[model samples]
Target: MQNDASTHPEGPAASDTPATPDAPVAAFPTTRAKGCPFDPPAELTRLREERPLTRLRYPDGHVGWLATGHAAVRAILGDVRFSSRYELAHVPFDTGFTGELPPAPTGDMTGIDAPEHTRYRRLLAGKFTVRRMRLLTERVEQITTEHLDAMERRGPVVDLMEAYARPIPALMICELLGVPYADQDMFQRHVATSMTLSSSEEERAAAMVAIDEYMRKLVMGKRTTPTDDLLGDLTTSDLTDDELTGIGGFLLGAGLDTTANMIAFGTFALLSNPDQLAALRAEPGLVDQAVEELMRYATIAQTGLRAALEDVEVEGRLIRKGESVALSMEAANRDPARFPDPDRLDLRRKATGHLGFGHGIHQCLGQQLARVEMRVAFPALLTRFPTLRLAAAPEDVPLREGMNIYGVHELPVTWGEAGGA
Candidate 1:
């Protein structure tokens, strides 16, 4: 992959209007905006109706198209024209370090496209199959109970993020990866640092190196005494050591933050929408529908990075080959064309398909695991603490700024005693 810094694409000429620029013209915001791009802009509905494809200037001055309309966003994700392999391009954001990171000790499966992506994904498919996820349901429930139980002892007002949101997924992933329970702290620390969007380049690099080293050692140990864990399964398969490490890294990198954000953001959503919360509390069976709605509304993966494989015309705009583009899933989720009253959080909405988990061949492999986690976490949470409410003002809560994944930095919540329901 080429690392030519000068390859950054130039922005298009400015337009007259501030709110929505006309097609075939690039418009740069005067100052960088923090938080998720989907933070419900004051004029988003108007912008969607007027300008579906708007030019966005990245913090690094790299220019790309941001697709806002639901149909357009879905086309970009599902179309063969747009490619996820953009490590070679001088894009500002990191695409989950799928490539452009140091050579994977195990070759990276995320960097490769299908047949190869399909093959590697297939090997691990069984691990995340519905049956496997069903087996994990009890363990997940237990983990959820433990977190809530701990919160009860310490609570009144609790940082739900620290007390519940972070640990449940962290513990579940540790269990699934077969990493020793005692070593979870070490792994969690590494995963936390490695996944930080606010960290500097040096800090991120250091974290990645530390995680790689840890995985290498774990892979070496598994090679000799393989167990029934996911790591052990990969080790015993036809995968190379490097391949094994890559899979492990992929799981570590993908699993924790996304699910953590889901827990945090989902909690915030539930609290902010009391009616929805009460509805779920009244009918606990709505957990599945509620999770889907949260995924659609929250859309933690705010922007996906992709490069134009070849010069392609999309929605009447010409995209040059190799130019980087941000597939704004958040914008797509709220597009009125796909979802009527897209802004409202409706639990009964017929969510046929959403780009919350992405689309096409490169869709998320751990989606099943994510669904299971949410399915277990939400219902149990509502049932455990029926009176759960936000401890902080919604406007005052600090959100993760300028990160690929949209999540709150902290979610302070209050609930009744553990098992109070």
Candidate 2:
């Protein structure tokens, strides 16, 4: 199950520096040469076996270690040795890191250490509870059905990303935030452009500014005339106006792009794997397990960024404080130790601890909602379009390359007559 150096070639040197006392010692290859190697797990596996704690030369030429093994990645992600809080330090990865970092919504909820992150996350937890998410099931179904209906009316060849993937979650998020449906288009546009690798600095900056302005307005409206939505509930809480606006921006940005990408990517995985798709078609009850498998196979968030909080030894290497690290969940999900034949997609795969939603306290907050959306959307999609097939050749499909999130730019699909059941 493990790949040897003979099977997989050694990637480019991690950096010029030799192993230091309190830094990542081994040199690993940079994704700059290959443009985010997470797409092909073979490359990640090579790194895992050969250079588990090697340095990665980012596009900007900054050196950061890329952790490639299952145990190491999970240990580091859960361990306090590595810190997710990076607001104060001169982020090494930030330089030339083209991905736009939206202005901290909720002020510093994303990059702060415990106590602060704990408090903010606590306030937000009740909002995304399973009970709250269950209450949203009927609405989610309605939203999914509405989008599917629109797609059918549009015709045979439909861009699933535009017609289905984006709208379902976009509309759901809009309903949750209590924003008017008319404004969903504007919010969707800004968030989409901001996440693209092709977007210019000016374009990304504009998107953030536009989103911030919209969130500020929405926060004010909620304060004056509250509705029974997430925003209104937040206003009543002790969080400040700035914090409220921050939450709005965070919800819009995170909820829109991530879930949309998941929908598109998850659909691509299902369509490409005929056996798994067929099994789901035969036994519809396995949809939940199928969704979990999809999340593991299509780890949309390829790698997560964290900084070393203090000196710590992992797998016999000493990592110093302030050093940047990239945890490759894509590799972790495929680790043979965790799952048998990690590459193959299995509908019945017992995928309990997959890091697709992440691990530890900083794990994704909207995971419950995301799971519900996927659980409802996919089975319904297949059952509706029994003969659904990929519109483009698997090799020719245009995947969003070089971005942190792995997704298809567009998913073109065709279905037979009598589209929905």
Candidate 3:
């Protein structure tokens, strides 16, 4: 909505620290309260309400602006004046990480600015076009059906995260990358290890190396004997062996983690809100809307980081050059100004313009595929198990609190045998 920061409601000042007369500042990375796991940190909400573009003290001791308002967040992300160079930006939060960030790895687009980013984005863009992704609809449906059938055969109670959520995306990504079924377990092992927040830096680094080595070998195989998949098709392109390997690893990691989390988290959100779950079951047509709403409500990709490449005035605040800015997607998506009754998970709500997939040039490249997967998966799960409900208490559901991605670590669920549709 409103882009003018001055016009935003100025509530009480943030309590992180005292603000000087010249610069309004607060600490970055507020913690989410225990009972309010689904909601953004209360401090973020307060900062957004009082001063959406206030100064933040990064963990690395860099003071930069934190954009929590929907408009401010979008404005920063859309503006190329901001940098996405991973080494240039500080996370300003607990990552068990310290010291300066390393330069953007060979093919990780998340850590680079444009020109280079533009090149990779352009090369891969054609593969993810809406039409191409839509073509996968039948395949997605088949995949969803197979998983549901397996669940039916095996379950009275099960960890849906393992049985349903994790595998769907993992399998889809494997198919897309043309990874052999025989090697999927190995591929998936490295991926899971690399993404674990609890893993030591050395462990994570080793996992990445293993993943890259495998990708390099996979790319070489595709070069000699191509197949009909994203990676195989890319072999025809002029990309170098190393570049192809990097891109392959990047896509596999991105495609698998985010969507898998959304599926598990979406199920948790709906189960917690029985009325919304019922609405989806009663009206299967609501699946599309529910997907967007759940993405908005879950806001799984909690925050985005950027550094000002040059001084720029945004949302009426002056952000100096070289300062890292953190955009709180979770907060902005739930901003009351943008979405009324933002906390309520109304499946019927026309939740357009959500930052769930983000916005701007670096917005998720695999969004269409993720949407198609969700559009099919969510409804199918509900339809297959009408009486599906959580077996664990809501509070006991383990969440990935300190992880880079926000989601449940596991979701135990059960359903009546006769409830299948």
Q: Best-fitting candidate, measured by lDDT?
A: 3
Model 3 Cα lDDT, one tens digit per residue, 1-421 = 1000111012332233323344545466558887677899888888889877778776555566789999899999899998777766666665566755566668888777779899999999998999999999999999889989999999768999889898887888889889865676676677767766567778878988998998898899889999999999999988889888998998888877889889999999999999998999999999989999999999988888887776688877777666677889999999889999998999999999999988999899999999999999998999898889988788999997766678998999999854442
TM-scores of all candidate predictions against the true structure = 0.85, 0.86, 0.92
Minimal lDDT window, size 10, model 2: 1-10
lDDT of each residue in 1-421, candidate 2, tens digit only: 0000010012332333534533442333324223322244556678776756666654444455678777778888788666665431222233244442432335545565687788889899988999989889999999899888887787778889988998888888888888887888888788767666566677877987898899898899889998998889889999888878877887777787788889888888887778988999898899889878888877887666676666578877765565567778887787777878887989999888888888887788899999899989988888887888877677666777655567878888887754532
Which digits, one per residue and each the tens of the lDDT, describe model 1 over residues 1-421? 1111223233543221222244422332212234333345434444567767666554445566666777777777777766555342434444333233332234455455566677888898888888888788888888889888988788678888888887877787877887766676676666666555656667766876887888888989999998888898788789888678877877866766789888898888878778888898999888888888888987887666556666677787766665655555777788888888888888878776888888877677788888888998898888888788877778667776555566787888876654442
The runs of at least 3 residues in candidate 2 whose Cα sits more than 4 Å from the true structure, single-residue gaps closed, are 1-41, 58-63, 87-108, 198-200, 417-421
Model 1 TM-score, 2 decimals: 0.85
In order, candidate lDDTs are 0.70, 0.72, 0.81
User: Quick one: ranking by lDDT, best first?
Assistant: 3, 2, 1
Error of 2 at 105 (Å): 5.3
Model 3, which residues run further than 4 Å from truth?
A: 1-26, 417-421
List clashing residue pairs in candidate 3.
Answer: none
**Which candidate number maximizes TM-score?**
3
Worst 10 residues of 3 by lDDT: 1-10
